[model samples]
Target: MPSQDEILAVILGGGRGSRLYPLTKMRSKPAVPMAGKYRLIDIPISNCINSEIFRIAILTQFNSVSLHRHIYRNYHFDNFHTGWVQIWAAEQTMQNADWYQGTADAVRKQLFEIIATRAKYVLILAGDHLYRMDYAAMARFHWEHNADITVAVQPVSKDEAHRFGILKRNPNFQLTEFAEKPHDPHLLEELVSRDDPQKPYLGSMGIYLFRTDVLVDLLNNYPLDDFGSHVIPQAITTHTVYGYDFTGYWEDIGTIRSFYETNLALTRPNPPFDFFDASAPIYGGTRFLPCSTVYDSKMKNVLLAEGCCIDHADIQDSIIGLRSQIASGVKIDKSIIMGADYYARTDQVDIGPIPMGIGQNCQIEGAIIDKNACIGKGVIIRSFPRGTDLDFDNWVVRDGIVVVPKSSILLDGTFIGPGSKD
Candidate 1:
């Protein structure tokens, strides 16, 4: 059996996340804010910790400043512990002078450093997913089946099958065939793993477990660029690959629409993915900030983070992030307010006339206000119909949701969305 210590997790920090645009404008997709306080990268790292897999490496190529900073502050194994978290950014080395071509190439470039860990297995994970998984259990299954590679798969419906790499498996859970985003009706039917009508095909969750030696060999010999497009298909033909069924609430936060829906889903009364699990708790940076203080706020099903001051606000089905300041008469519904990085002090000079956070009497609906956004008083921001995409100086609409990027400033009485002037 594979012990927890013998497993090294290598989380892919993803490419230039063009699908998740303005959110990825300043930071990488993995570093994007999630739920209220945690980041997308935090999910995988926290799961590794909970699974007792301590040796981890994060492969970052795109904007990774925030991701690196978060890891430095949040994850620190003490001197007594042998565990360590490494950030392997893309570098132009003597051998390779190019950036990470894809997921496989990213690991191929770092194979030298990864081989030095002397671990028995390597767990490949995606950074921009929302789920809680016990990787140790998957490791045990990998050992029991004596498989060279194990891919984590979840049952996805035909409607959702077009978005993921679907696979067909045998009764013993061995993956027989794999197809990347098969849209044809005949091929989709052939890929069905179960007899269920709703969810028939098994979609790859972009998670793979491999024997360390086998992984090193495949990357060295194949010269492939991607796992989904190239590597996995070849591996299935050559290696003893198996599928581990995962029936959890797994979501890929790859697009603007998915990101928006996933964030708002957390505001539900009983969310599919809850962060309050004490046994397998999600970990993040420690700010040591005071508890949020809400005075005369009519909030329902809102996940408010720490260091926030909400006074006389009517917020419903939303997520207010850390250090968020919501003034009186603010109305926010079905939105995600990623709070400021720092609380602006009254004594601080050079700060603009409009204060940080939402000003008084602002009406925001179905929008995502990124970090450090300064919305002035009487600012009316709302959503538009699906397929409505427009870009302005301060904000942009992608998939009908208004997105105010980081450090954006909206002037007093600025109107956006439905009836607002561009």
Candidate 2:
């Protein structure tokens, strides 16, 4: 097995996440809060720490202020240890006067720094994925196979295969062909594993392990910008590329619908991804807040974070984030409420009728309330009967879930439901 010191992990934080919309309005996609207490970037970073691969660099562009702060504040290595996590934001220099064109381009620009580390292998990962992976196992697989490049693949349903870059591997798991988002049924069938025709096709998980020399050569010779679109296909023809099959829980939380559904799934009795696994635990910043206090509230299947106050409310199948304030007579169901940044002081002046958190008599269902939002009293946020494809004043309905943007304020008695207009 290769030592962790010989591998440098680079997490690619993609460009502005337009799909996440209002959530990405103030913060980068990776920096966006997930599962109430942890941010999206924490998943991959935690995985690396668990796998004992600590030397890392996060390549980010687009609204990186919060992302930088979160990483710096949360991750701190011991003075004696050489392991460290650093952010390498995009910059315009004389050599490269442009932003990252794609994933491949981003890494290519940082090749100098990566090579300086003198690592034998490079592990490239996506910043927005939610999963737990032991990268050491993957590294061993790459070394045993003597592969120039090893791509981590997962079996996805035929219905979902069209959303990913598909690949066909031989009996030895050597990648033969690669196609990005193939729609043709004939092509899809060819991509399916020969072992079981009924089994789902092997789709790329966007996790890559590359030999240092091979990676450097490919980046320098190829002018391609993206790995999925340009680099991988080209590498398959000339270099030895193998597939590492991974059968685990993985979700790319790139869109609002996926993000909303993933968080809600955690509220289930048996969540696909377990955060309480002692063997491999997810790490997040420790905010020493008071324990949540509930008063005469009926709650079930809820993951309430620290510093929350619930009073005479009925909350079911929901995730209440840190420092969430819920008043009396409020009923919340099947929703994700990302709580406030800080507690409202007694001397704080009320900007409107409602203060900071959910007001009294407010009924919310099938919605995602962003951080620091002020929802006034008697406000009803529910799906539209006609269909949820409309944009209201402070929120937008997507995938039948009303999403209240960050720091938005809804006035008193605001009712949003089916057929809601601008």
Candidate 3:
């Protein structure tokens, strides 16, 4: 634990991740299940462990108790004297400000707790991304440049540059300009001279390295502005901010489409990202159970986590979460079900409403059934169930979204209506 150590890690896990909607409705984004088993929080936590950076803190709020419990049970290492990976939840007190305002302000408020442990530099990372990165190398790049702030940059298409922070960097990799979603002159859009290999611009990965003292000072007067919207761009005029180009398997699984698409990724032959690679495995906390069992079920190219029970069903291109149960004669296709339980019991017996269940002989075609919902047998739930195009009170969705509410029951052979899915 020397003063000259290259890095410390801060995981920004406080956001509600509302974009993920029903997935995040009950759990924080970091706690959302990924590729069948791993929670979103496990990504950065595992990355830090595998990359040889042990001391880290997860800053969490908004349904964080579950996220906290998962981290406590799963993230473990045996050989560290001064290194520990843990969490930092908001503590409402008499003097300090309450709750996190934003990502930057969250760190700004927790300076004492972070500094209490004597970390030299703070590496800020997000909790919702899915990628395998050697952050140790990225940190080394930061130290070599003596950068006041170092941002991980990647080359992105001009159309996609609007989706992220765009940076204009000089030949030396010194960032010249940063735009938080520019209208035109996209990041990395300019053509490089035929003789030069460097691209036009670099897009920020929303990952950054900040010198401890410099970060504290800058955040102190940061005026409640975010790193992307204000701190990064403003710092470019004076502070030494550099870009580190990164090329790897990285995706922000923050939206429903992205989540579904990512699940569909595993089905590809020799996919770009493989979770089962034992050598470079993305370590998540192992559930205390044997591998998932499939009985009388037809499964193809799906990712099923431990503790799952599948019986007499056809599941394909889906991500089933931990401890989930798929009953007989059901078909779940191209869906993402996160460790949700579908039992036949609940407290909604008054109006005959009950807990969730997707029953046998049911066709849940390209639809989402939220947690705790009970769908009866022989039911057809879909935006276009049979393509019958029948004239019988036909249901037409606004965004063509269909959802089965949590803790509700659809009677046998019932047809549920649709609206914006998320």
**Per-candidate clashes, comma-separated:** 0, 2, 9
- In TM-score terms, candidate 2 sits at 0.97
In model 1, the worst 10-residue window by lDDT is 413-422
- Residue-wise lDDT of candidate 3 within 1-422, one digit each (tens)? 22324468899995877566656766788887677667788888777777777788898888887788888887766764666778888778676657887888888878887788677789899998888888878777877888899999887665565687888778787888767776654324442211334434467888988888888888886585477787888788869999887888789887756765776686666766777666567877665666778898888867777767777999876666666666688887765555554333445565354224456777665555555555667777665433322222222221233444334466777865443222
Q: For model 1, how does the per-residue alpha-carbon lDDT over 204-250 read when each residue is reduced to its tens digit?
A: 99999999899988999987999888888999999999999999999
Candidate 3, pairs of clashing residues: 188-201, 321-339, 356-372, 356-373, 356-374, 357-373, 357-374, 357-375, 372-407
- Give the Cα error of residue 133 in candidate 3, in Å: 0.3
lDDT per residue (tens digit) for residues 79-108 in model 2: 999999999999988899999999999999
Q: Is candidate 2 or candidate 3 better by TM-score?
A: 2
**lDDT for every model?**
0.93, 0.91, 0.70
* RMSD in Å for all candidates: 1.0, 1.4, 4.9
TM-score, candidate 1, is 0.98
Could you tell me every candidate's TM-score relative to the true structure?
Answer: 0.98, 0.97, 0.85
The candidate maximizing lDDT is: 1
Q: Candidate 1 at 272: error in angstroms?
A: 0.9
Q: Model 3 RMSD to the real structure?
A: 4.9
